[model samples]
Target: MPHQLAVTIRAALPAARVAEVSELLAEAGRKGVAGELFPFAEVTGVHFARLLVVPEGPPGADGAPVPASVVYMSEVDAPLQSHLTDLVRKAGEGLEKVFGHCDGYPTGSASVAARTAWLRAHRIPSAAFYVNTVGRGRQQILREARLREAIEEFLDQQGAALSGAPPSRIRAAVQEHVRGRPDLAWARSRPAPPALWWRIRQKAHLVALPVVALFLLPLLLFALPVWAVLLRLHELRDAPGRDRPDRRHLRELAACEDFGAQNPFTAVGSVKPGRFRRATLTAVLLVVDYGVRHFFNRGDLTGVKTIHFARWLFIDDKRRVLFASNYDGSLESYMDDFIDKVAWGLNAVFSNGLGYPRTRWLVLGGAKDELAFKNYLRCHQLPTHVWYSAYDDLTTATIDTNARIRAGLFADLGPAATRAWLALL
Candidate 1:
């Protein structure tokens, strides 16, 4: 029995016109015909319409729906079920016709004839019609009525051919198409075979394989020596037997150490408590605790050489003298102690150097200790600079120096420093 698929008309289509289209679908289902109603909305603006109908039941069942499928109400008066396998095959042709006469009346006799021939060939049983008349006036109602009459006449003529088909089969076919079952649609739209060059091109990468190998050869050759040196350095630095070295290790190991020996008041490593005998002009860097010791050991300073306990000397180097210390102990108890001790010692150093040479002090505190450092600097009336260096070129610095660093000096520096120290580089 042809499946009796329920037909519905939605959108702004009139009640009478919708009933007429639904009656045509009901009659088609009773006569064992199978097809779809291209909703008024789908066909009204379109120059042509196409639909696919498949049989219901288990896969490979005998007379299981027309695997060949059908195309109904296309602009071209093609047969309903030609051996052509896929609806997509004729989509471009249909779209061309739809967009070609975009503004014309859609329900003329010539249009009706073409639509009837396509529907008759497809043997559609049930369909839902929808019209979107969001803006049209009374003229749209008349056009829909004419379209309904034409579609009913076509269904009536194809009634005899649909006689033996079960209504259930028709319903299932319509459901499958509406739900977009590609497997059922696949039999109708058999895809063309791949081009000959497609498979051959997959192997073309082999031809460029040698060139890629050659390009990487020089990089590998150059990288080997540098990598070996770095590996050796890593091994020496992290050797297992060595004692855990402290901040003074580097400075103690090097000979001819010059931590402000060139000028008075300029010291690189920790300074002990003592006054210099000579008329000194240098910056004194006092390392208070272990944290400050580590800051001096960083690569930028090379290594701590000496801690002149007494005299603060000033140097004539173009670069600013930075005194950095660390605060990593207990925040509540030792924090005030650390700040007071460090600040007093730094003030003394700055005061002693003021008479001889100009100097700047940089305190390196951990993330948690920044607040304490800021409060201490604020209380002491010492000029302070804040630096934030993070991912990419997001490094920033704000200096409280009376004189601003010149732009020309920063431009001479590399791109990284220029961006990082935009305020004072």
Candidate 2:
């Protein structure tokens, strides 16, 4: 399961300490997954992880500065509690060092249990979450990636000797190569299937959707006009964010970007005030959560496959939203993809945030207003202080490809299937 943890920096912390904390995180970012302070690889099952200090936005009605938060978020295979246990056990000293600067961290006790409890206390439940492919754990990914490389290496050494061979012959040779190697022997067998209860829940959710829709049909019809009127009224009077980001802010965001094949995006913005907007955003996220779990679990989110994991969470009494994603490619290309492929989906969720590009309905005309939408995103975007990826060399597409190759390695295949499998090499 993908999980996140966020803790607010103590507003009472001296300014000099905050600067030291920032420098510490920047140093970790430079060291990447193997940093001496917090080696991300030491804590297993994490696909991606990041530590960032993001603003909580402007002062509240009390006119006091809201503390900027130190967010430690990760996507892991096990349940969050289990992952946190591993995190504390493996990186106890490093975690204490980093989190000590934050508010609410137990000061006197440095025990693993105490640190884990604090992390649990500050945990934020995502309003919605997405994984490009469910059930693909870090261990499986690394193993299969190694499998692909070994097969490719074998093919290279055999060079052209198998060039004119039949598909079966080529596949047979590849299978033989894998079978003869101890390390690649795992690829000769299939992995365990998902648990029975998981399958049952998936099917049950699929079956229940239409039934629920039918039950709500009459109420929906009755409320349609009123809902439309309310939505249009809000849309007409809503403030649209059109301001350009400051040059220095843009530079700061860009500094940590484009360093790897994958990049981390963390943005926070105030939610549009009032019950109606909040309800609309809530409903949208509910539907998105359903669709991603039941529909988009197979590596695509509405034709956009670049994201490995993404999440949205409502924070600070639902007055603000935090959007974060681990995506492949440069940020420019990423924005273009959403604009070109799934602009309406962007409009659906983001239009409820303060200073978004205008939307006609809940799903149209917002992200389609490209320039304004990009500006809105840049304006809210925050610089990530540190980021890590388990497989920095692989993109989502490459991971899918590797999994497919592993899946077909020991399968009985027809000529067409064999040819397709060979093509994957």
Q: Encode model 2's per-residue lDDT on 1-425: one tens digit a residue.
A: 22222222222233446677777787776666435666778787778877776664666668776666667888877566678888888766666666777776865656777877888888887888888887777888899899999999999988789888888998899999888999777787776655567768778988897789899999989987897899999999988976999999998888789887899998998889888998889888988888887889788998899999998888777778888999999999999999999998898899999899888878889998888999999999988867778998899999999999999998888899999999999
Cα-based RMSD of candidate 1 = 40.1
Error of 2 at 280 (Å): 0.6
Best by lDDT: 2
Highest TM-score among the candidates is held by which one? 2
lDDT value, residue 58 of candidate 1 = 22
Q: What is the C-alpha lDDT of each candidate?
A: 0.27, 0.81
lDDT of 1 by residue, 80-113 (tens): 2331222323232432222222222133333444
Q: How many residue pairs clash per model?
A: 52, 1
Model 2 regions lying over 4 Å from their true place: 1-17, 30-34, 59-65, 107-109, 201-213
